[model samples]
Target: MTSPVPSVDLRLVDLLRHDLTAADFTVPGVEAVVGPTAAAALHREQDVPARRAVAAVLRAVADPAAVLTALWVLGEDVTRRQVDAALPGLGADGAVALGLVEASGQGADDAVRAAVDLRPYAAQDAVGEVTWWLASDLSELQTGRRLAADHVLGAGGASLTLAQVTMRDPRGRVLDLGTGCGIQALHAARHAGSVVATDISRRALAFAAFNAALDQPDAVTALDLREGSMLEPVTGERFDLVVSNPPFVITPRTGAAGGGASGLPDYEYRDGGRAGDDLVRDLVVGLGEVLEPGGVAQLLGNWEHRRGEPWTERVGSWLDAAGLDGWVVQREVLDPAEYAETWLRDGGSTSDRDPAVWADAYGAWLDDFASRDVEAVGFGIVTLRRPDPAAAPAGRVTLRRLEEHTGSVRQPLGAHLAAVLAAHDRLQGLDDDALAAQRLVVAPDVTEERYLTPGAADPNVVLLRQGDGLGRAVHASTSLAALTGASDGELTVGQITGAIAALFDVSATDLAAELLPAVRGLVTDGFLLLPQ
Candidate 1:
């Protein structure tokens, strides 16, 4: 498989970066060239509006970003002169030298075609806000064809999800596994002192290196790029943090290479070249070998929902083998047919495009699921932490949380996840009595809603809803509601629970024991906050 990934030349990359900066090729810059509606339409994979908008801009003036948008983002070919004007610093020559664009013909009036998809990227994370450019292989959207077997991905949905959910605390060493295009590695570099990014595809590593050079010119040396599958490149090494958006996509193994109709190409960016769900399970189980004690690893995965079996048991079995504090949040569930359609469409092998191939591939997906009695597939974020040996509960995995929440949640969830981890550790350090003695306050984003019969004084139902961080809606018992409502940071939990117990004619100690666990949950869920 011959894949043409971008080459890395620091000098040329620097010149290109300079040209991009001067041309105002940025998130805001792109939006300015194309109106908001057009910019927003691209998210839906509809580029007609954007093409028309940029064409309108070009008709008025040779706006650098507008020209760049048409050629680079919309996948349109342009005259060499337009490329020169748009990137005055690097000009057409430098872009061609960098393998970003190529000359269409030998004539002086020859056109220039984008060899890679280069676009401005912007995101606000725990480290801070960043605006950088990412270069990856042209997608089916640009090529107007099916993706190549070794497609290097840009910042897609999974990449962004893993980035937003990653814990961003400063660390000594970090590893980005299967780092296609190095987007996660770049985000990690903002906080990690050093990053070792590895991928099974050298083309991916090439793109990763190029992206690193373009975005972090001074810190280009900070990223050590390696090429190997999963943890093989970092064997016998321990990292304080490990992040991955691995090639966990479950694909039918039709051949030795997992390719060429039910012949789905083994997309290096997604397919792990393994059997169903086993790749993800093995990756989770093997992570303990590479993580330092108390180190954290966050990644996204898909698990099978088999018939006559619960999803929790399926995923929990992996956590038990990992021997780490594991938390799995199943975010989405798709039926077998839907799953087939989603992945087929993702690889640009849709029914309309290729009905025969789509039918073959779609039937293969259904048969593949039926083999394992898989009724559906659940996708979500997975966070694992290796327990420190020195801790009291050293010998076993003390934390195991498997929950499902398929709803809107806050983005840039790094801080929230970090805070919740801290809260869990703090709670673990305290006993029931210690927890009761602590003062707690309701989070400002939290609200209470009560439903009652017509003109009834007492409510029929009480709901304590979190406005952020999974947006949990807890069914608060009358006592629990009273406890949170009176939690104004003045009264200790012991005092408040005692008062409520007396008013309800219940034993104080029993009430404290009952509410203490609930209190701990609230603290972890961001419904209640510990005093600063």
Candidate 2:
């Protein structure tokens, strides 16, 4: 039976009609009250009369569907009725003082705040409302939230990572592949003259368009939202920048939503269909053609590590196959068992429901891996730039780990790119004296360390490490130990060699001869940053 829709609160509608402005929500002391009180209220057993009154007002609406629609518009979900029940009486303005509307007007940053100290229910509602308000201004807020419920919103971690790692050079046109909520496209529009956003789901595309309007209305003219897979929608169109967070999960055909060969329609966000991580492979493979010469692409994905092949080698092989100059970072890795469980639950499957189905689903995943000789699965981001054939660029690939967990605005990704681009050619031929004459500086938060083997005559090994950012090896070398050690930013190669020869009891001429090649090697590799 189609359940009769319930009624909504006219008071809520009235409040919405006269929305409060951001400046009006900065009441002093109100924040403290709202945080604790709202929390307390959400967990309480007793339903306060004021809260009940608000619930009564909501239930009075003639069409519950309309109420749900309005609530969603207000940046909330109808599925959470308990939250609606506590909305009215619990806010930052003290108990029974004001509702969210009135309190917000009194300078509460959040729509809902705690009315009492340590009130659990109110506090819970406060947290939820805080999240709801973040994406509230965004038109794609509701759809993105609905699609990934209870997950935090806004230009968050994954979003910001893509933004920072995105290719920022001026381009003819940019394409935001799988433009979830139009975030990548919106960011890209700032750099590109034209931007096209593509997604498989019409609903996702709609949200993308709406978000683009809210965030970048003027750029809206240059932005195009298309509904289709990877490059399918814009088959003939090539782009300078292509960014995507495609559906990269690899799972079996049954008991999973929108994955496997037959289930593309069920889950548009992360299901890549074919078993054993085919979606990521397809995306990686196709990028070669979709990108224009000298174009760049950034993608966040997961890939499996089979038994026989190292994960780094496996990914490198793909880049090799695609025939591109790529720098890849494999941030984290998880075993099949742990990886399976995390994603299974993430897809909204409860282990308790249908034990046989859960077991079978998991078994299929393991078997799929076994068949492919897979050992562990890796999750990371890949940035690729198609080489300009005329430039005759070597297809260089780098695989490494990221040390930092959170995003920082101070990162020098731009400088890193600049450094790589500057040193694209071989740095091997410079004589030690010539190399030393060039002023060199290490990247920010980077240092060189020397290590020696115990009881061995072999010279010390030189290693480079970063203080922050990706904090990985610049390069390691035992043969070039003196060259790096002499990089105290004080002496030229001839000067350092003269000193090193004296200290190590070697001839000055021989030391310079030996160290020159090593210093040249350092420059040839990316260990030392050369002056322009």
Residue 142, candidate 2: C-alpha displacement in angstroms: 11
TM, every model: 0.96, 0.65
lDDT tens readout by residue for model 2, 28-128 = 22222224443245224122432433344457642332222224322332322322332323222322232221123433333432211110001111001
The worst-scoring run of ten residues by lDDT in candidate 1 lies at 254-263
What are the runs in model 2 whose C-alpha is more than 4 Å off?
1-157, 254-266, 351-357, 393-418, 425-437, 448-463, 473-499, 507-527
Per-candidate clashes, comma-separated: 0, 37
Stretches of model 1 off by over 4 angstroms after superposition: 1-3, 105-108, 255-258
Tens digits of per-residue lDDT, candidate 1, 1-532, equal: 3446778878888889998999999999999998899989998898999999998999999899998999889889888888888888787888888899888765646899989999999987766788999999987888887788888999998898889889999999999999999999999998999999999888899999999999988788999999898899999999999999998888878632247534668788999877889999999999999999999999999999999999999999999999899999999999999988788888877624657777788888888888899999999999999998776365557789999999998888888888888888778778888888889999998999999999999999999998877788999889999999999999999999999999999999998888998999999888888888
Query: Model 2 scores what on Cα lDDT?
Result: 0.53
Which candidate gets the maximum lDDT versus the true structure?
Answer: 1
Q: Which residue pairs overlap in candidate 1's backbone?
A: none
Q: What is the lDDT of residue 323 in candidate 2?
A: 74
